[model samples]
Each structure stands twice: as structure tokens, then as C-alpha cells.
Target: MAVHHPATIVPTKLELLQAWVPHQPWLGGADVSTVTRLGSYRFDDPDGEVGMETHLLSTDDGRVLQVPLTYRGAPRVGAEGSLITTMTHTTLGNRWIYDGCHDPVYVTALVRAILTGGRHADLYAATDGGLVLEPATTHVRGSGSWSSADVPALTAPVVSHHGTTTTIHAGVRLTLPRVLVATTPAADASLSGTWPGQETPVVLATVDGSS
Candidate 1:
């Protein structure tokens, strides 16, 4: 069964956003005055420790942006495959939570859900054999890359002061916490350097899982 995490105690989506939004890089800042749910998706982890939620947010304009996060109570042992590294310190100590989605099993399940038309995607599995997530409110689809159980590609780029253009190369140091570069033919990697104030993808994508 899918498990629910502490976040479920949140009485409203806004409350949850208020608590979790500032911690994420894509959420803009602690001063965010407004947030409207554009669209969202959930995934069930077979192991059940980490809850994954994919949310799309935007300003008053219709331009939508995506934020995929893995909510974990704690971190894993020697979590080398993690993408975004972040931790919150509670009164007890540090509540270890990073993007563990690169774990092969985690990636596999995400791929499966995308391929199958499952009715519910609310599920999470931790590396320590713990599971949590609300099991009844979500489903998932669209599996394209299942054979290559490789780590998600990582690109290093720094957003311009205006947050439009990004400089990229092989070893450039990046200031962002995590950038999910989608690998495929369906991903629109068509970036624009000539234009300012344009929407550059924080999550670079592939169209057909091609490199």
C-alpha cells in the first residue's frame, strides 16, 4: 500500500507550499507572494520511503514550469547517486532529504509508471525499507527510457542575472542546487541565447531519450 508522509498533515495545499516551497530552488524565494497549482503528478515507489511529487507552477501568465521532488524523512547511506543535495535541521538534528530519484530502482518505477496507465501514483520507498505517501490521489504515465538504467544526465550552467541565458560547457561550476536535464527526442532543448527574459529550461529534456 502507498504510505502518507508527515506533509499530509497540512490542511491545505497552500500550507504545504508555504512550508516546502522556500526550501526548493525552483520556488523562486521566501518572498513568493502567490502560487497557483497549474498541474501535478504523483508516483508510487515500490519500496516506499520517499514520496515523489511533480508540480507545475507559474506566474499570472500561462507559462508553466515543472518541479519534481522526492520527499524523504532522512538520507540514505553513501547517497552517491543523489542529484540535489539539501537538508533541513529539526530540533532533533538534520532531517536528511535529497533528490534520490537517480537510484536505479526509483528511476525504474518512474519509467514503469510513465509506461503503464496506473490509477494511483502516490507512493514512496526509502533506501532503509521505509515507505510513505498518500496512496489514493494520483496516477502516472509516459515511459520511454527503461533499458539504460543510467544516472540522469547532469549539465552545468549558470543562469544570467536576469534568469534568461545560461552558459554551458564540460566542467563549468553551477550554482543551482539541481537541474533535471531530460534526455530524449521529445524534450525541447531549443534554448535561446540571443533573447533576454525568455524561458530557459531549468530541466533540460530529450525528445526520444537520445543523447
Candidate 2:
């Protein structure tokens, strides 16, 4: 389960994206001001220390983009280049945001999910009354069915980016399509998602164990 706080955050997620997204080379020079939030999905961190979420945003040109992010209370060692920004959370205090593709915690969770048929984490909101179950706006599922597959421990994964996709090699190879599309590609195992306006599931990540 993923718990969310009702408290406000300085430099809201959208604001940060507005200042950062446009500069990404994969978008083909798209503008952030015209971007709109489509939906988001979450993967639970077993240790519960890091927050993993993937946001789906739509561009004015009808292109949907995928941005996976991880939130940490402190800086992640050796991830200075991947740091998105630092912001204050009213309830959680200081937070260091990093692109999930470069975070080990996220890579572990993602690989596990894809290899074990994992689904999106349940969402809960912390309120004055208590923890309340909140409906998730986006849904995701992994295609793998190897429930007993041993997930290899990954450390300091080698990451690369090109065009509209990013690839990570850490025992298991993962292909993350930054730009969302409608068709699902062939892969050993994969992750796909669906949102409100986009009910048709679209492939988000693909896994190849050949590595």
C-alpha cells in the first residue's frame, strides 16, 4: 500500500515538471506549459522508505509521456545527476526527488513486479480521522507469471537514453518508453497501464532476461 499525505508541497509536481520536462531531449522539443496530467500509478517499496510513482502526462500534440519518479527523505548516494529537485513537504518535511529510472529502489521494485506478475499498489490517504482508502486514477499490471522466479539483486545499473525511450541494464534489461503508444510490443515480460481518457492499455515497460 502507498500512503499519501494531504499536506501541501512547495514547487508542486507540475511546477517542477514545467521547469524540467521541456529540456529533455527525448520529447523532440515539446513545451511543458502545454502538458496536462493524465494519471499516475504506484509501486510499493518493500522497505517503505522510498515512494515510487509513475506519472502519465499528455502533450498538446496528443502525445502521452511517461515519467517514473522516486521520492526520498534524503539524497540518494551517487544519484546526483538523476536528482530532479528538492522540495519541502508539509507532512514529510524535506524530500529529494529523483528520476525513478536511475534509483535502485525503483529498479528493484519494477523488475520484481515484471517478473512476478505484480500489480499497482493500493493507495491510502492520511487524514485527520485516519487512513482512508483512495481510488487510484491509473491502473497497471505486469505480464510475467513466474511467481517463483528469483529476482536478481541489482546494483549501480547502467542506464542509457535515446530518442523517446530509456534502457536500464541491471541483471535484467528493462525498456521504458518515454512516449506512450497504443500497441503492446513483444517481450519476455512487460508492464502496461490504462487511464481515464486512455482506457486502452498501453505498454509502459518491457523486460528481457537475456542480459
Candidate 3:
């Protein structure tokens, strides 16, 4: 389960995205000001050190963009290029934000989810009463089933972005589409999701063994 705090955060997620999205080459000249959050899902870090969340956004031009982010107490080694910005959380203090594609922890979670039939982390609100379960607006599931014998092992990963897709080369290749599309190629392992209006499951990420 993923516990969330109601504390205030400086330079809110929207503000940070507004500043960062306009510069990305994959946006195809879409207006950043019109960007709005459509839905989001989270992946739990077993060690509970990092906050992993993937945001789904929509623009006035009818583009749905996927942006995965990770929040950590300290900067990730060798991921300076992926740093989006730093922010202060009223409860958690300072946070270092990075694009999830370049963060090993996030990559591991994605790979594990794809290989182990994982689902979006369940959400809970940290309240004075207690941890209260919250209904998830976005849903996701992996196509593969857990198999202790077929565990995925991710080593040093090389990440690159091409057009609207990002690729990560490690023990397995992970392909993530920055822009949501209705159709995607079948892969050895894949994660698919459905949002409010889009009941059809769309492939969000895929993984295949290294050749």
C-alpha cells in the first residue's frame, strides 16, 4: 500500500510540470499551459525509501502524456541529467525529483511489476484517525505471472528517449510510450492501464529479454 500525506508541497506537481514539459521535444508543440492531470498510479518501493508515481496528463490538443517521477530524500547517483526539480514537502522536508526512467529504483519496480503480474499500489491517506484506504482513479496490471524461478534481474541500465517513446536497456529492454496510444505491440512482458473515460486497457510499458 502507498500512504499519502495531505501536507502542502512547494512548487506543486502541476507547476513543475508546466515548466518542464514545454521544453521536451516529444510534446510536438503542444501548449503546456493547457496541461491538466487526468489520472495517476503509484508503484510501492519495497524498502520504502522512494516515492514512485506516474502521472497521466491531458492537453487541450487531445494528447495524453505519461510522465513517471520518483521522489527521494537525496539525489540519485548518475541521474543528474534526469533531475526535474527539487521541492519542499511540509511533512517530509526536502525532496529530490527525477524522471523515473533514469532512476534505478523506479526501473526495478517497473520491471518487477511487468514480470510478476503487479498492479498499481493501493493508496491510503495518512489521517489522524488512521490510515484510510482510498479508491484509486487509475488502474494498471501486468500481463505476466509471478514465478520465483523466472525472476527479473536488472543491472546497470542505459536509458534513451526517441520521439515520444523512452527505452531502457538493461537485463531486459523496457519500452514506455510518453504519449498514450490505443495500440501497442505485444511483448514478453507488458503493463496496461485503464482510466476514467478510457475503459480500454492501453499498453503503458513493455519489457523483453535482452537479445
- Tens digit per residue, CA lDDT, model 1, 1-211: 4443343232244345545545544433323455566445566666766666655454443344444556565666666444454444232233444342334333444434333322235455433456644333222334243333342443322122213212222122211122222231332212111112323323321122331
Clash count per candidate: 34, 0, 0
Which of the two, 2 or 3, has more lDDT? 3
Q: lDDT of each model, Cα atoms only?
A: 0.39, 0.86, 0.88
Model 1 regions lying over 4 Å from their true place? 5-33, 77-97, 100-106, 115-139, 143-211
Off by over 4 Å in 3: none
Task: Write one digit per residue (lDDT tens) for candidate 2, span 75-169.
Answer: 98878999999989999999999989989889888888888889999999998899999987799998888764576677667788888889998
* Per-prediction TM-score to the true structure, in the order listed: 0.43, 0.95, 0.95
Query: Model 3 — TM-score against the truth?
Result: 0.95
lDDT of 3 by residue, 1-211 (tens): 8999999999999888878887876765666676889899999998999999999999888888999999999988878899999999999999999988888889988988888999999999999999999999899998899774576677877887788888999788999998888877656689999987889899999988872
User: Candidate 2 regions off by >4 Å?
Assistant: 29-31
Clashes of 2: 0
Model 2: weakest 10-residue lDDT segment is: 25-34
1 against 3, candidate with superior TM-score: 3
RMSD of candidates 1 onward, in order: 10.0, 1.4, 1.5
Candidate number with greatest lDDT: 3
